[model samples]
Target: MPKMIFVNLPITDLDRSISFYEAVGGRREPKFSNDRAAMIVLSDTISVMLLTHDFYSTFTRKPIADAHRTSQVLLALSADSVADVDATIDKASSAGGKVDPGPKQEMGDLMYGRSFEDPDGHHWEIMWMDPQAAEQGASAFEQA
Candidate 1:
């Protein structure tokens, strides 16, 4: 059986959050959605649960962190190539997300990566690697 990953996030407004996510390449999962929460599907095995503040608080006793002030998590997505990573980052920023400083480049033959932040302050990293370089034990992109 294939394993699935669910990331739950607290949002100020369910509808607003859903719209922002949709603009940044997230698709709504109607089967898992309701008035207080919506499921943002990323891939077959990955999904993000956007829950209203009131609804999310019920799931945990600890206080929810203010994402605007500080981030509690960083979500990374891998791309097949460096150009693909850059394109996604551009789309994210155009859709109301924020890009990090810039892309960090590794001068070796192994890997390359770029990072950005989502509208909700979630950090994201996009990366690509050469299979041949991995077999040679290259560690160029490991630091980023």
Candidate 2:
């Protein structure tokens, strides 16, 4: 079988987090979901595990850092086009999520990205890359 990745995030509200993920195009896997946690399938190989704080604390000995104030990691996903990136962010905003303040990225028309914060304050970035340019060679924005 092929490898798969599960990004585990501690969430204060299980139901709300599940709703937020679904709003941004994630499909909830009921087979792996329950009151304590929810498995949001971002793709066939990628899943986001939204675990309750009590359940998440069981996995580590250290204190759970407040995601709203800390920047340990940023969850990023690729989109088909720049419009897709914007659409996802817009859905996030309408679902009570917050958009991260920053200029939208554009790598000379080959790439674009936007950022948003989930209801639980987990940072996420949606980006699009030109497939033809990516297959050709190095990006034009790359330094010599």
Candidate 3:
């Protein structure tokens, strides 16, 4: 069996988070979801468990850090192409997510990336990488 990953996050609104994830290629798994939590399946092996602050608190003794004020993690996902990275992030912004102000990164023809923040301010990065470009030592960076 293939290993699976569940990234658990504390969210203020379950429904809104689920909607946002759906816009970015996730499907809700009702079997593992409820009023307190929603399981958003991103891929066959990747899922995001959106839990209410109260529900998430039950699993940890530490106080939940406000994602709006401080970042604890940056959730990243790979895309098939640079266009996909832009499309996904654009969808996220249209769904009320905050697009990061940073400039997009383009590493020659090898890699491209962008970032966005969910309503709860959880950071997410969308990226694409090409092995052939890397193998040829192509670079977009200017040497000083």
On TM-score, the candidate that comes out on top is: 2
Score each candidate by Cα lDDT.
0.77, 0.89, 0.88
Tens-digit lDDT string for candidate 3 (12-90): 9999999999998899999999999999999999999999999999999999989888879888898999899999999
Q: How far does residue 124 in candidate 2 sit from its true spot (Å)?
A: 0.6
Residue 8 local lDDT, model 1 = 94
Candidate 3, which segments miss by more than 4 Å at Cα?
Answer: 101-103, 133-144
How much is the lDDT of residue 40 in candidate 1?
98
Where does candidate 1 have its weakest 10-residue lDDT segment?
135-144
| Steric clashes per prediction | 0, 0, 0
Which stretches in model 1 have alpha-carbon errors above 4 Å? 101-108, 134-144
Estimate candidate 3's alpha-carbon lDDT, on a 0 to 1 scale.
0.88
The number of the candidate with the highest lDDT is 2
For model 1, how does the per-residue alpha-carbon lDDT over 1-144 read when each residue is reduced to its tens digit? Answer: 699999998877778778877876789999999999999998899899998889998999999888667867767776777778778778777777777644575545567777776556667777777776656563534542
